[model samples]
Target: MSEKTVIDLSRLRKPDYNGSVQELYFLEEHPEWMVCKTMPGGSVFDVGTIFSIPNSDICRTALRHKIYSLLETPEEWENIYGHICRKYARDKEFLAFLSEGPLEDFRLRGADTHHLGMIDRDTGEVYRKSFPPHPSQYVLVKKYKIIKPSRVSYNDNHLWDYSEYYGADKFVVPLENIVRIGLTSGSSIYRNYLNMNDAERKNYLKELGLREELVPWTLFAKPVVDFTTKYEPEDRSLKLQEALHVSGSSGKKLLDIIKMCILGAILVSEFFRKIGLFLWDLKWEIARDGDKLVFVDTIDTDSIRVTTKANYNNKDYFVNFNKQSMRDYYKIMHSQWFEATKSAKAAALKSGKSFLEHLRAGQAEGYYPGTPQVDRRFIDIQEDKFNTLIAYIYGQATLDSTIEKYNEIGLKEIGYYDANGVLEEYDKLNGMGEETVVRSQ
Candidate 1:
């Protein structure tokens, strides 16, 4: 449905000229496709997306993806082009790298894919900050001329030092605060979801450089760090060229977003620390709109580590607050739960039942085979922890507002893990009703 247009940057550079973007327009014919188009009301611009391609110049592919993400694209494909649609486009520096890296030597590593990312910038509405994966791609010739920019490699990323570990990608990130230490008494290895019977399973474990006595699963290792960041299309340095920009509204907004992000990062970091859990990884990113600060990203699931109290069980295992732990624990449950689920599935098959029917039947029949009193693990643990975290964040808003939401659900506390007295009835604010007044407890 929409027309396709391609502008070749094969010659954006010239030996005689220093070059100027002032004389060029990336989307002159398709101004709407530009990520930062001025809005109709004149108050804001549509901060949109870019397009991408696979097995080509990653920077260029990411650049195109950044553009396409913010605008419209063809909904259906008619051919098997081996193309994948990945959201969260790279930042401007990446495009420059593709445009002007040393043509003969520039290579993109698997880790290079995460230099920077952009999410949901097309609309000026409420945004949901997402974690990474999938990338838009653009195919380019193996041999091409290079037109370099003063800035290249979009991120001053923190590349992981797990060179001896598995996988080519090593968790490269920018603005990451990390403290690496050599393994003294123990070694840690990251896990991949290879089938239990996969041929490489033995090799994968062997690569951890393990000794005969070190039980691999008992090692106290940190969780995988999933990086998150706001996709700022244009850097502040370029915007400063427009005016005495440090005092400019946009510049101030950028500063505000960064400050708020840091505050949030520190807040959670301290909360977990107080619980005797040390978080080795906490990431934050922000996008700006005038004076407003948008908290763009915070790594969830893999973000926190609930370190088991050392020596409590004589097996110091560090529990990462994530889904995998729940799934694995569920799979290994005392065989009773597993058998019940199998029986329920068979009964459903004989009855010609759908998922909902099976679920209701299972629940009515007490298919999970639980005693009235029980010890919880896995899903039960993660659910309570996640719910408490959710409550704490929301509970930070106005006491009256938080109470309003709390009352609607008839929930005094979102869950047992809420430790801050978030919905306690005896609190001064919760005690006051039907009248707005300033009072002391």
Candidate 2:
């Protein structure tokens, strides 16, 4: 394993008041912070990562609440959010979080979002997710997507034509597949568990030593690509089977399959994600129900990467911010890193080091492409301030108020501290004083 390196966050400063203890704890303990399939050991950081923003739900929500104006078209959104990103990026606490390398994990997470995180199954069948930098094996899951048939709406079809067709989710699965809660996708698993047969489910939960309604995220069964007899075309079917086989493989076998998929991944990037957030199109299930992986498709994560010109790449390749100026900053760093790596890889030939080995030795974990050194007007802020700003943005962007309401309902339904802790933490992390606004802005 590469030695973990943290970011050089001298820009952001601390705040007067202490940030929320619980919120800080969650950031520290989030499973992505740990090594895969192991506890007590920490995972190395990846700085090439950027936040995912595929859909317009956050924009719509902000618009509805007057956080965005009607004139705030997609182009306008870029300007507003770009400003927000640049401002927050310099916050001290946010810097600290980024230093820990939480941003690079390929799981879909956020408070107000529709989807949940990935499931880590005991059977060792983790969900197959693809990244722009690298892609893994993928299951078709939704058969209808590949071959469109009747029973689909016209309006949705128009929109669907532009969306990434292959998808998955863990919102609902069979009773037997339900295992422990996942780090990110626990919300979806628990919600699916609610729909299971209650009487048998209770007995099963007792046997598992979990309260009938306890939230055991981290260990879970997520929804994956499963193809059934509903589709035609023998070649396509064979191709999908190949995809699944590759997705289930390990070591070099996995890398081989990923290279093949990369052929179509660029197109997947073009149509599906405006910000290259392929994670939006994926929701792999770990439910080992002894059934064949079906070839059914379901359009989820509100796929539509609408953006104005040069919004996604002119600035930052990882995140478009749907804006220009912000993108430039991102682009400089990302392109520099990629170029540096390309040079590094060539140089490593003399050292007999592979590219992966090169990255581990040089610029992989704890490496943000071009930052701190690149920015001219760098600030030396306090750490507490960074915490306040991050907590505020995370809570608000994830729909803090809505989550609190849902938390209240879950408490009434299940009556557990864990039931409400997610939202409770959100509450504690958000709503800083006016100083937060002045400092960040």
Candidate 3:
């Protein structure tokens, strides 16, 4: 057993950053530590999973730490977490968040209970009997305090948004994001390339004017956007800081971060594979650590998407263990509002406006549909499924006793409603291995 360390965050400072999904703060005692708390906006909007999100978050975070700790050399570990933080160590609080059983059991079982004396940020009292009904929504990870250099800025460039292109915007660089996609059908790149022949695919790449180095990866099962290049034709080179519209700092570059992400993906994918699930894709949030880029935020079921191997050959291939269900619920139950949002977003993009802007305008004009409240029955079903998924993943419950039943319900709903039309379109696109390469374990 490892030695225990105290985690006194009672002197926690106000959040340094207020992100869309989570807030970032540091403790007075452990100044190097970063404390993350999930917020209501972004992904948590529909289902109201503020309290429960941390349960999944801490589990995956600990799992990542476990995988990375297996590295033999200090250099190997440094390549990933060195410049950002020396290590990833879990105290009593981390374990407490994940403990479904009594906290006393963990102490009795020889687990380090040092951080058990941790004071709650809100109440400023140590947990005595057990954790609250739902443990505190916090992601506690040790990280180096990034001292900003006089010449460089870590603001804009550091927040790398690896997402799909809803429109041409300051944040949404379609070409760059397309290159970062994985094999999952949820990616627009995957769906777009699903039906194209090699020649047509080649033409498509040429039409988009993608860099030659990136062309090879566009069709790969996992495309890591590591190639160094200029985003524009006339530019000599694309400096990381300049590309992100920031200044410069001092060890590794963008490619280094991309390599780390790939390594993380492999580690996560292998772990899930062992548990009879395939890790599909991930939404990475990396920040500049002085001179290095390190992954921040959580890596739970919320950030990563996974599917069962049983659906590998079926139309429901990319059906995942995430908020896709909530999305499907909207598509089926509130089709008008869903269609209206899509149309309004498209129009907004055409006029060089954002979806948010369109939403505001549409509401004022009585044209945009308001997001209807989700039925209480649907929300209950989803919460039950989420709990069962966590329980199933952690070995607290058997598969058939939990997620399997929910999976059946989910499949039936999605299939019957033809939610998102992914299944039918996939079938029409010629099923598995027809036009594109369907790589699987």
Can you give the TM-score per candidate against the true fold?
A: 0.24, 0.22, 0.57
RMSD of 1: 23.0
Candidate 2 local lDDT, 357-440, one digit each (tens) = 666566545552432233322111111212222233334324454334333332222222124333232222221223321221
Q: Give the top-scoring candidate (TM-score).
A: 3
Ten residues in sequence with the least summed lDDT for candidate 1: 38-47
Candidate 3 wrong stretches, greater than 4 Å: 1-18, 26-31, 39-135, 142-182, 191-223, 226-252, 309-318, 343-354, 398-441
Give lDDT for model 1: 0.28
Worst 10 residues of 2 by lDDT: 35-44
Cα lDDT tens digits for candidate 1, 1-441: 122323333332422211110012133343322211111110001111111111222222333233222211122110101111111023344223222321112122111111122222222221112211332221111111111112223254322222221121111112222111111111222223223354455654343323322222332221121212112222211122222122223444333333333333333444444434434334343322322323322234332233322221122223334322332332333346545555654555454343335544666777565312222332344444444334433333454543343332222122221243332321221122222111110
After superposition of all CA atoms, the RMSD between model 3 and the true structure is 12.2
Model 2 TM-score relative to the real fold = 0.22
Provide the overall lDDT of each model, using Cα atoms, as 2-decimal numbers. 0.28, 0.25, 0.43
lDDT of 2 at 268: 30
Candidate 3, which ten residues in sequence have the lowest lDDT sum?
Answer: 169-178
Candidate order by lDDT, decreasing, is 3, 1, 2
